[model samples]
Target chain A: MEQILRYRVQNDFSALSRFLEELRGLPGYARLNERQAYRLGLVLEEMISNIIKYGYDDSKVHEIEVVIRWGDMKITVELSDDGHPFDPMRHHCPGSNSAEPLEQRPIGGLGIHLARQMSEEMTYRRENGRNILQIQIGGGVAGD
Target chain B: MEIGFEMKDKMTIVHLQGRLDAETSPAAESQLLPRLSASGGNWLVDLKDLEFISSAGLRVFLMLAKRARECGTKLTLCSLRPGVRNVFEISGFCTIFAIEDSPAGI
Candidate 1:
């Protein structure tokens, strides 16, 4: 069986926290093991935080739509925002070269990088002035 | 999130409890950054009770690590849960910060 959940989240930290708590309360969430739940939360937090921080240029409030499709072995999240046309897949991840000294490493893209690493698959697209990102988690294979 | 401090030897053990995500990261940064100084000795962040961490939380750790380096001090993390450890490793933070299984020795 599959379950679908949808939420309209405000572009703010408080809303994000509330949404995350609600997500944890879902019946499907109970099926996820500790590691899977943690990865899901991390991916959601990283992606939504980026949208709240950089997806907008104006100070106006916006609503981000999130859809979660919870399956028996996998969970998929679809996030749509009307803020900007940014693609997370193409975002440059700095500070990844471990060979570089710590002091010289820049800390700009670690968030997106972490999100990408935790999720099984991530795809981004722009449609009708909205940036839509879909991320899949579970299936037992994540950044081992 | 709640942060408590304990002094062991010359090291400062920071106990972090609760979730450290975007909602709490700003406060965590403000509260933790001012405590680091050149004269201060090493720091070991204890995340045993920390239920969750996101990129925002990671950013604060990165900043703290950078500041600790600038102040000529060492920063280590210990007692990371499996979930938390995965985040650190995936972000390559494991290479930057010294990690321990427990807070046994500084």
Candidate 2:
């Protein structure tokens, strides 16, 4: 069996927060520790925010599909967006390992790099004109 | 996430409650940056109620600290939760920044 939650909302930030809260209550997410859960929420928010701001080019409404599955020892979260197909993993992350001053440095594309650093395994692919990204989280008790 | 401010003479105290993820970090950054300009050499960040934080959230802290340093003000974090503390340790921020178990100690 699989758990799925789909959302269609305006390019608003509140919708992302509500979607993350829903994931926190899922059975599959119950196994993750606070750190993993928080990281997962951050990754999801960053991806969604990028799509909302840059993917749709200010489109009024965007649809996102989130599918979660509980494996024997791992939890998989897949997020698919119908906005533009952009792979964040390949984006150039500014201020990466730099000693530049904060005001001088631009806040460019660091979210994706941060997400990759926190997740145990992360993959991104474009399928059916949608960006499909999956993350595997473990290192906790088994799901009840 | 809820952010409350307390003015301690010239020092500013920011209390962060709830989870500070990518979504909430921007709010923190926006609220904290402008306050740093008037800080009289000290800013205390109270994270006692913060249950969890990710890299995205941590970035906000780093940015604040960097800005404070440039302005000759100090940014100190107090009362970090265990999970949030672990993120600091992993990021090697524990040594670079001043962190205490409680605000009273800071």
Best by lDDT: 1
Per-candidate TM-score against the hidden true structure: 0.91, 0.77
Q: Specify the CAPRI tier of model 1.
A: medium
Q: State the iRMSD of every prediction, in order shown.
A: 1.7, 4.0
DockQ of 2: 0.37
Q: lDDT tens string, model 2, B1-106? A: 8989888877789888988775678888888788787666588999999977765677787778777888898888999887778667655567658998898986
- DockQ of candidates 1 onward, in order? 0.67, 0.37
Q: Candidate 1 on A48-142: residue-level lDDT in tens?
A: 98898898989888999999887767889999999889998888778665567877888646788888888889999899999999999975544
Task: Summing lDDT over every window of 10 consecutive residues in candidate 1 chain A, give the lowest-scoring window.
Answer: A135-144
True contacts kept of each: 0.71, 0.21
Best by TM-score: 1
- Against the reference, the lDDT scores of all candidates come to 0.86, 0.72
- Give the per-residue lDDT of model 2 (tens digit) for A5-124: 455544677877777777788776776565556666656676677777787866467777776665445557787888888887788766454455455655445566656666678889
- Which lDDT value does model 1 have at A140? 51
Q: Of the candidates shown, which would achieve the greatest DockQ relative to the real structure? A: 1
lDDT of 2 at A2: 45
Clashes of 2: 0
Output the worst ten-in-a-row residue range by lDDT, candidate 1 chain B: B33-42
